[model samples]
Target: MRVGKASDTDVEQVGTMREGKLDQKHLLFGEDDSPNNYDLNMGLTGGGGWRTPRHRHNFDQIRYVIQGELPYTETEVLKEGWVGYFPESVHYGPQERAEGLRTMVLQCGGASGQGYLSVARREAVNAELNKVGEFKKGLYHYTDANGVAQTKDGSEAIFEHATGGALRFAAPRYTDVIAMDPDAYDWHKSQDTGVEEKWLGRFTERDLRIGFLRLDAGAVYQAGQFNSIEILFQTKGRVTAGGTEYGPETGYEFLANEGPVQVEAVEPTEFLRMVLHTF
Candidate 1:
């Protein structure tokens, strides 16, 4: 098992930080197949300051709040530990005020050799119903071993049938992002599970496989026939991946180019895992 750690200074690309106003910590940027298009950044804003004017983009956007509160025009105001998903070809502009605004932003898909916003347009008073509709649809669902829908409302929250987490780099098109509560599970120490095991769920979409994983202390786990790149984010405790040892609040990534590697839990651990398979 290997792991990697991303430091505060390691992320310095400020996509839109105003002087003495706001700052962005890009955790994972320029990864996977969609190099020019993919971006995951954290934003922090100062008090008594205004955020960048509302704008639109050709690509999709997802914002997860790690702390504090921020408001969106169409969606409701989000506080700490909330996630907001914006679909491709939609408009999302925020007018927020806070002691400081902090958020994690993820972007996927590319078009016409353009980066981020294709054109710089003026900020507008967004229409109540911003866009006609969104390009993509809902999250993928699964039927449990009992043949009943594991997720009653949707797959965004807990999914009993989910085996392993899915990744956008693996199944770019079918990948749908979700915001979840970290304290949703009753986590136990690794020694509890006799054998080290992880279940990456079935493909929600043909090319997409997403789920969660838990490992016992010193338990080694691996996958066969992965045929796609996988991304894992440390959600609970600590673990090692890709020749690195990472603890909580760290992200580790691996390409299936070689073969499946050992994934072991140093302590008890959980991860937000996603594998994107080529069709």
Candidate 2:
């Protein structure tokens, strides 16, 4: 089991085509070679807003809006407390935001068999690409080995070169975006004392699970041994686990067989729980 405080994590600034000047705090990063390997991060888009070109990833991604808003489609916007899921190779975006957009993002290998790449790793590749090409207006301009000027979609070019043309994979489990509002779900009391839960939805094709937990003040909750990777993001009030107190924006990750965990609510608290089963 691993717990982290948002205030304690370093904020990293990465400059790139898709990211712009956004700030990110990495909460968890899974092992590189494992299909279940994943990355969870909180991203903050500052005053000037953020924009990204239309593109697709080899992996799947889920974004939960924590604050502000971003447009998923010309007519659809993701506001606070909303969630959006993007499956592998499903193109969407030309993403844009006006100001103060904050989101928690989870990325993992898609059921399509394509691998996952960390933001850090992707940044490294971007840096290398910069030396040989230039990213401008959401496109990459380069002179290939044949010395011919070429142009390609920025994200497509980067992933292709980074994976050495091995980026293709089986079709994704879901081809369209999935969006939801957790607040719209009904809460169900847990068998555990003082704990109530709301199941958001499950993407069985990707072994993904999502839900919310609400714990009353001074209540204790016991977590059973998990058979998958579990991530908890504090959404309201305060909770203590493993001798550390966590408030909103803080998150924790527990691996399979990590055993039962004891969680205590220092105050009335609520959190979003996401799990990726190994099956």
Candidate 3:
């Protein structure tokens, strides 16, 4: 089991691949050797906020709004406390996020086996690309081999630059992005006493899952006993595990069936749980 706290993580400005300003607190990073390596982070839109063109990725993402709403499209909005699932190769935004909007995001490899890119690698390429071209707004402006002026999506440009090849996207499996409201779902009792769950749904053959877990004060719950990587993010209250006390904003990780670790709730605690995609 791996545990980390948001307070221990430093807040950093977002990469220049996207438009505007945002700051993030990265909570957890998955095994780098694995194809499904991922990053879990929480970010807040700064002064001018942020925007993204109508774009898609080769990876999957799960986003939860903590404060303010997410303008997913020109017409659709995900209000505070809502969640969204962005499937690989699926397009959604042309978004214009308002200032002070805070969101928790998980980005990982999708079912298509196209491994996600690491931030470290991407940022390295960003610096290299900076010497050749300029990133303005959400686009990269450059002069290609033919000496012709070109403009491309900043993220796509970074990927191609890093790999020295054209960026490719998988054939989309899901027709559209999924938006969910957790409050509309009812919490059901889990097998463990004093523990309950509100499962949103599972996705793809990989069995990726999104859910909420609640543990009443003084209760001990066994966590991380799953066939795939399981992550639990403490959203409210406090808990103690392996003799360590963890408060809100703490994140825990367990490898496939690596645990049934004991976690005791010091206060009535709630957690956002994710079962990552299995290869």
Top candidate when judged by lDDT against the true structure: 3
lDDT of 2 by residue, 90-206 (tens): 877778876678889988877655568766767888899999889876788999889999988877777787778755756656666788888799998888889999977888565
Q: Cα lDDT of all candidates, in order?
A: 0.45, 0.79, 0.89
TM-scores, one per candidate = 0.55, 0.92, 0.97
RMSD to truth, every model = 14.9, 1.9, 1.1
Rate residue 116 of model 1 by lDDT. Answer: 39
lDDT of 1: 0.45
* Cα misplacement distance, residue 21 of candidate 2 (Å): 2.3
Q: Which order, best to worst by TM-score?
A: 3, 2, 1
Q: Which tens-of-lDDT digit does each residue in 177-240 have in candidate 3?
A: 8999999999999988999999998999889999999999998889878898898888998999
Please say which candidate is ahead in TM-score: 1 or 2. 2
The segments of candidate 3 whose C-alpha lies over 4 angstroms from its true place after superposition are none
lDDT of 2: 0.79
Higher lDDT: candidate 1 or 3? Answer: 3
Clashes of each: 27, 0, 0
Query: Considering only N, C-alpha and C atoms within 3 Å, which residue pairs clash in candidate 3?
Result: none
- Sort by lDDT, best first: what order? 3, 2, 1
